[model samples]
Target: MDANGGIEIERKFDVDELAVLPPLIDLPGVQAIAEPVVHDLEAVYFDTNDLVLSAARITLRRRTGGDDAGWHLKLPQNAGRRREIHAPLGRDRQGEADAVPESLAQLVRVYVRAAPLVPVARLTTIRVVHALIGAGGETLAVLCDDRVQAERLVHEPASAAWREWEFELVDAPEDLLDAGQAVLAVAGILVSGHASKLARALGDRLTAESPRNRQRPTPTGPAGNVLLASLGEQIGVIRAQDPRIRQHTLGSVHAMRVALRRLRSVLATYRSLVDPTVVQHLRTELGWLAAVLGGSRDEEVLQRRLAGLLDREDPAVLLGSIRDRLTTRSAADAATARHTLVVALDSHRYFRLLDALDALAASPPFTATAGQDARVVVPALVTKEWKKLRRAVRRATGTVPGPERDLALHEVRKRAKRLRYAAETAHPLNPKRAARVSGFAQKLQTILGDQHDSVIARERLLRRGGVDAYLRGENTFSYGRLHALEQQKAADAEALFWKAWSHRP
Candidate 1:
């Protein structure tokens, strides 16, 4: 059973007393599904250039004798969160590590650094599973019982060993979780307190005990280092989002692009804080990743909007093959962009760039401009962003309130969003002021974003009629109506932006 496009919701609990229900597999009202038992399974995880990925807070593993056995790459999509990808095991557990296959390796290029893939650890789990189902016979959740053990570097002497229970939920409701927990509470069976057992087990590699988690890097002189560190973290975020975007995860592409823009925005806003050469190089790479992924993301956004429009359109008004032509063209363009993204991720240059980024992050090249504290540092950043916004607004202001104005305003809106985020981060000094700025920036951005989306949709509609026959099907009316509505929507938003920005912050 391959699962895709399904939402995975997981919640963890703390377990205390285990002396509860005599290892029973059946509930009081339910039949005994299977006798309570535990089975041992061994797995060896692999990674490139060494165990560096583990440092990035991710794990790639190949396991045997497990209920689900395969090559698993548990990528860290966010803090305390992961997206697991499982591939079937090879014919034999041999010859599996073949240069970290480009498709997969590209997903983790930011962390692996071109390192040759190798086995780093062996984990053995003694476990039991209970499957819960709903009234309609749909599987809900799988409760796992486990005793875990680990040996570092399967071939070498053991370096790490630990034990813990792991609970992974399936298609269960939130309320049922509360009910189950209450049952466990009454039985004196509690949940595990650890956020993740892997973190506890690989403490040495992860610096799990380090104070660095909460401690912001000690600010040197003017806070230049702080800016660089922020930029680096954003870069990491963009790279981490790559795999999710490829999988067409909702909002993933937009998020990654935002990170890129933020990084670029930082450079533009704080030009005096760092060397221009460094900023230029990073910007180049950022542009490259963005351009590569742009097609897929843009198509996705347009397609989603077009579909909605098609749903509402009067069937008769739709023109010749409009929707079909656009759909085909978009799919082809999206595929090409995806390929380029994957290839770029696998390139040696990309790896080299990541390594350089790591080094820069660990120790940024700070100039004298960094000595200022938040009050001084922030105003400069915000001012720079404001100037960029101002220029874009000015460019957009004189244009006829049409597509060109809409597009230019959209760019300005983006600048406003970044500036707003930067301002929000600086709220500690003045909460009310930050709150006001964020609110204003948001309204402008929303209007601009909607307008830009409309423009794109209209262009797509025009192309659809000009091209493919597939789009000429029963849904053509939707495109024309949508295009007209979007045009009106953009005009309305522009009016809103002017009304709001008129009162300066």
Candidate 2:
């Protein structure tokens, strides 16, 4: 059997109802039971040298328990989602107690700070399971009554806490929670305060992992060598989200996109730190990934914006089948776009790109900028970014306020964003100056962001113009309207850009 199960939904609730006055009386066919048996569980968790699992907010444990128990590796599958893998007892969840599993440890190889996985903490849970099934006999909820004991890292003295819950799941028509809640309400049972007993027990320890501290030392020797350390972190994020995105495990696409953008942004920001040729190669691949995913995101944004616009207008002035037409075409486009993203992810090129990036991160080819110590080097970096912004503003000012001007300003906006991120990364050394540069870069980016959104909206319409005519039986009138609005926004952005640019030092 597969050790890993796909994403599982786990929820918890309080048992105060039966504990307090007026015990659960509802349920025409059911009788009430006061006491139930609970068993104590003990588990020690481990992670790789870099704490990959923890950095990804995943927890792995080896536990001795009540009914269903074994070595468990719980990996994150998006917000409030997790994939639990079970292995036979006596061995570490990853393989051995002292050493990390090669397969799992490979994932964190880039940040191998510590030598081996160590005992982080121990958790003991007293669990009670209640069967809530219907006459046709399907389980609706598993009411679990729990009391927990926790010990800090390396088998320190233990701590204890008591709690109870009803874990609701989907096996019936209505929400299992509603029926269970209705019964528990009469008994004065309230939902659990913490999301999970483990979460509550860990307290501050849950928030211990930080990526920066986990980073491997910058490979060194000579000056002018640029380190792409940040890119490795970004790639790690992308890989971590891949399986979740495949599962459509909520917010996966957005998270993946953010990771890609951060990697691309790092390339753009630290152009002087690393090899431009390599950066260019990486950017092209990143652009392809972004474009593949951008279609769905763009349509999502347009549908939302257009619907908001139509909502404010008189229903009569809406003209044509705007909502239906957009929805029909958008759904088709979204499906195609999703397929493209999946295929691209599976391609050999993508893997090659990842391999290349990992190599670069490990031993970056830094330029002259890398030679200077962070203290002497950072301000000059800030100044270089300021210069780029100044050049963009200059190019944009002389041009007439139109499509050409909009495009130019958008380019400037891109530069500003790159500078802002670079400044943020350098902020540890010179907090005050870095903050000022970041703030100004942000204002410039905002102006450009509005303009760029308009530009993309127009590009999307042009691409969809033909498809809209064939499917919706129209010449893309709605798209045209959106394009016009976007152009106007671009015009408006020119005024805003100049106003914002003038304020920057």
Candidate 3:
């Protein structure tokens, strides 16, 4: 099962008091409809006093009397789609019901922070479910008719009742939905205006302080506009990855790290357009966040590379317990890294950083040069980064292939990354030229990145000291061989970097 949750593709419709569902078996791609199954479900929803989760279009509830009864969290994905995560309902201190699972609660920490969560609504639903089957007997979709009664539990209790129909896709194509909609329209049914039952139950209480309503206006002038746009784009990335990182989704940490780097690069590259002191402070915080995330990212990369190398080697040459050792180390590192990340997320500093980012987006402190044309200002910034890369590369190639030269090349790699980010920022103005520069910088970055990986691998191998091999009754010859090979690969990467630089644009 996906830790982040499963994607749900479904649509809802409001029905009149006497309305009935149209024949779904005859819909396109649906061969038959199974007998209806009735379920009586009661759910209690939890949220902050201010309805933070509802405003974000998220819902968390504990449901009883269902086939998959447990805790369910639904997060909005796109129009008519949601990602649903589930957890078991274990016992609490009184042996009644447990509080929210730590795993699930952590995912929402970005929204609730230190706020207390309480029961906001309770709902009882009587649902009739019919499965739409294809010719091959595969379940393609499900049609549900629901009668719902909801009671607001907090801040002046109230009760309401309603009926609705929901058509949800299983493995069927989208055309089936169009057919279903056509049939429903003929029966005088229309899509529901509210996003969910919870939304309708809350009514006007679910204030309009949504992120969409809080978006900043477009800044004027070329420089300010470009800088603001890039900052806003990266800020969105950071926010989107927060829950994914909490869920421990694959590659989420690396993606969040890259977004932080891009945001920091924009601050540095367009410093003249914003307040210098504020940009410096933000850059420092971004650097700290990136370093925290990099811990696990580096371990993940090394484990993959070493495992791949071991897999391709001859069985006779393969040393004892190499794979097991790598696995143990990787697991330990990942646990520690994730703990560090969770601690940071739960801190006041992280919340303040998020607030600072929002403020920067909404009302940036623009300098005198912010009103200039981007075509004129952006090119100069790109040129400056390119020059920095050239100087670093020259210094790297000037030294012999050793630790000094390796360090120099690492500096070159950092410069290349900055230049690539700058070129990407300039893409909106001159796409063709920016593409050339970005492509060239990426090639350099890739070569040096491999070189750095080899360095890290060799250091790890040396630290191992053949303890696992000795315990497994094998010699340490393979470890020495691997180290020698990595050293040679690092040298080859350095050579490749110079060769690629000769054709730099």
Candidate 4:
């Protein structure tokens, strides 16, 4: 969900042609009903050739003839919730056609990659609305009795008509939905089987719209199925976080990067299950994407870290304008980094990479070993990853407190993350053991991750304290103090990591 997105909480019911509108004043907490208002609404739904968006339970439409008329992108959330994003139906370059807004289109690029969007369904809704006013005169909800005429534009055109009621909350208590449903049930109006009017219009055709067009992963089946499942979940996170990154949502960049890294780790850890050639390509491209998201996130983290350090320092030790300088530099770097990330996301390379991922999800390139039993295959893979982390830890423990130790700890952190993901993928086979292993692996990753962050922080502090401060003619003393503080932080993380490792099973 982005800036234009909001949660849509509504309950819809199917009714007879002559279903009478129930008495509203008698419903719980209702004080009055505003006079009915009528509006004729039209919505044109769009999707790819195979109805990819439909398969994903997403709907994108260019709608007209309502108080709110534009483009609507509806994405499924929780069982009773849908996240709806609105974008103005902007004009074509020559005003010849109504083009989908870029803001909305970009959000769905992961699902719609390399496929053209065409009209799939058209719906005409004649809606009569009655506002359900609360005792305080607040419009808690609105009830719309709709007479819908739907026409399927794709694959053997068809039409259908129906009457339905939409009970949507405005500012009402969400439990009001249960009450409204009970009322509609009493009126002998059952909940609509259709998820949306478009689904109803498409009717029989929707049952035919199955994700079976893509392969389903099963734990008892191909070993590659497990890898694909893991890969698919991470891919979804990467896609879901795209718009959040655009909105500059807190921690979004880190989330996207972590997903990208997880995908790479899965490919690397399960190298025997997938084609080496395809795995290399995906791992390389995923690394590229992660790098693109990393710049801004690093600056954001450093800014916070430095700010926290400064806050804890004695007021008298604070140098002249040091805080302002840090703020200005960080802000400028973040802007540049954010712009670069946006451009990269919108680039043809990124889109092509997404297309490749979609293709991979639909039909992963599996190797001969992929057909083995997961119970045997998964444990071996998990053990292999654990050994890698163990080796890295041994090396880090052997090193003294120097640059070599810092580098070794960073390597250990990366391996720990790999082991954690591998253990997670192995969970279906042995939940108890997988959980225990994953727990220890994550503890290692977290503390070592902090150590890695401190390592980078020290390098950054050196540059800022030496070159930047020298050039700006600011006090260098505070920078040295902060550098020393970061070093201590790194030592603390190392100690914690060792303590956790000593107790590992």
Candidate 5:
């Protein structure tokens, strides 16, 4: 079935049994309220027994008895908004209760991994919906009064009941929501502290304080603390980008790729603070992921650069079908690369990799050095990477401009990236110094990145047989001119890098 998805922006307020809703029509920008429509919504929320999805504030449910009933996955977004993805409810080949629908399950795979999903809570809500309309008869927002009866289905069956009001924006300004809140305050309805219905339904199981919450303060002397925190941050990024990557959102693939790179860099840079065997294994797996994501990222970068360059070219020198050819090639390549990414994401190896990451975060293999002060150990690591970058830059600039120089510069770029990541991990402890180092490293990385792009673009242009200009009886001279221009740009970047290196702190 074709999927439907959108961002759901709404606010929920707890209402006492005796409270009455204030006039929504009088709210700013609301001219009228439509007749209330009632919906009896029966939803069974699914999650792993451990409630991983719920902890992350994601909800997946198969609902019936509503106008828009199906399997819905709600991913938490910023500021009381959710990105909801919906799939039509249907039985699997074996005729089960939709079997979580592959479309929705894949989105949460990063959280649940190989764990089995089961019904965690069953909720029956009687909803009275009012449409607040604008003067132009457009729906400004929706007001839903929900009477909820929730039963926890896992571990032990228990039940609870509540009434809440949801004010959801449709085509209204945010100020309208603020106005509605102010009006509701007069009637004593206040925003609920609970994040979601599932959180309220599961009660203490979902909200209970873990032992980690009660642990003593973080050790100030532990390099392991800094390294683990850095690893955790990247893991969070990887998980956050997983759903977006599955949806093929622009820049999601690159974000996930960068997260993997940073994770690998931290593991390598802090190998002395962790078990070598485990770190090596993680590094290998991360390399695999990076390689899988690189194809699409490279193509995406090349397509953007070529398009921008073509846009700036004079019409007189523009050749036949060049834009069309590039577009077609880029689209085809992207489609294939995206397919590869999806397959990788669905593979058993990928699932195991996620499990490994969770395991690492929960219990890292810290060595004796891990207990040392980050202030002492981290700067040494950053300095080591900086030295590596300096050597690579020196070798690259001393060489004549050619394929050899390009290769050397590429190495410099890689070292600069590692140095930047190391500096980032150290930034939490010493912000000013780390910021300066990171800034310098970023400048060098950008310059070398451009040179690398030019190298790749020239190779790609050559592979395309000079842009097919002969088809329109036009000379391919423009292609040669573009190639030479890219070369000059690379040379210019190299010279700039040398100048910057002379004054390097």
Candidate 6:
């Protein structure tokens, strides 16, 4: 699925400008080498004046003359790999600064906010491609030797020329990248110091403008550093999920909401390390975003779960328009919810929230405790979360099976989740038994989450199936049966939660 969006898993090397090429078809996993093909490609890269995309290891460009020439957005996926998205050149063939494809722009909206994406660099490449074929005549990889002319789009617009070799995997395993790198390394070729063409093209100008290289104040204490790093990771996850959500990718909305919750949980758990007012504001905004995503996600979940339940039910009990009402109403509700979610995602308010989050990641407001030794302070924070979880669990278990208990169990699930996140953040330098607590919290969380889902399902069946279908004169027998099943599922989940909690570490 990750590769469905054209993930580029490749390795690159900088070869001497006039260096002779190495032997053609001798690398590992190569059965034959296809005839060489040449392409003269011209590209223009875009970014803010401050090089926001470049700083984040992202590149957006419009190119012509290549077989796949169009608008390309290359985003960092992992080490030595990028998720490349391609869209038509559309109206920006002449390289209009503000004419970036809206589809691509939305993916980077969190970064560029209101900033214009102007031409930052231009590249013209004379690329000779050699395809390395593997078992069963599969094209394992493409090797390109590119002689390039790059011009920095600045006040003076400096130009540089160089030649480099690119080995990109097609139908090859990740080990192929390392294998090819080894083959190239033996021939006096090393990995390129520059990360990409845009990075190389910008030259020292990139270093001068990129915020990543700029010096900052003294580093925070260990505990503060750990918390901030966790926060940054969650922020990265949210940003990465943005395009997936826009594309209606399954589980993206839920993944994004989880990231938001983790971010808020970190701030709340480590409140003593940061300024109260600022942390509170960030948490409020994160909650707002999560709620907005939850609306669409909950609807979709209900519809899907009900559909699955219907599939397993006996045909004899299925009566009236119950399935139709469920399908029709849920579909409409999910669509409306999705529309609202998209609007919220594109709103100025959401952009401002993103800005706040970025600011928080860049430089957080720290209190005196932030300077303390993490060994002494971090344990207490995790302990606090655990204690809260214990209290919630006790209250929830003591309550009778009713709405109040359902609410209490939900509270327990939230607390357990917070503990799980805090312990995970502290897992790296763990000394406070974080692993044990995290294991217990994770199991408890899963059990309780199932119960909460059943709670929601029951309510949905009552409202959508019971009342709505009743008003329409459709027999409500199926709704009653489904509702009873949901009730039993909730009871069974609660029993599992208590049994698991008893032996929790």
Candidate 3 weakest ten by summed lDDT: 212-221
TM-score of 4: 0.91
lDDT of 1 at 393: 83
The segments of candidate 1 whose C-alpha lies over 4 angstroms from its true place after superposition are 1-38, 76-84, 92-107, 123-150, 154-156, 159-233, 306-311, 398-411, 457-490
Between candidates 2 and 3, the TM-score winner: 3
lDDT of prediction 3:
0.83
Judging by TM-score, tell me the better candidate of 5 and 6: 6
The lDDT for every candidate, in the order shown, is 0.63, 0.63, 0.83, 0.84, 0.84, 0.85
lDDT, model 1, position 386: 74
Residues 400-421, candidate 2: write the lDDT tens digits: 7667776678788878887887
lDDT of 4 by residue, 282-310 (tens): 89999998898888888888888888888
- The CA lDDT at 335 in model 5 is 80
* Model 4 ranges with Cα > 4 A deviation: 1-5, 88-93, 114-118, 154-157, 203-222
Q: Which runs in model 6 stand beyond 4 Å of their true positions?
A: 1-5, 29-32, 92-98, 133-138, 174-179, 208-221
In Å, residue 207's CA in model 4 sits off its true spot by 6.8
Pick out the ten consecutive residues of candidate 1 with the lowest summed lDDT: 208-217
Better of 3 and 6 by TM-score: 6
Candidate 1 similarity to native, TM-score: 0.73
**TM-score of every candidate:** 0.73, 0.58, 0.87, 0.91, 0.88, 0.91
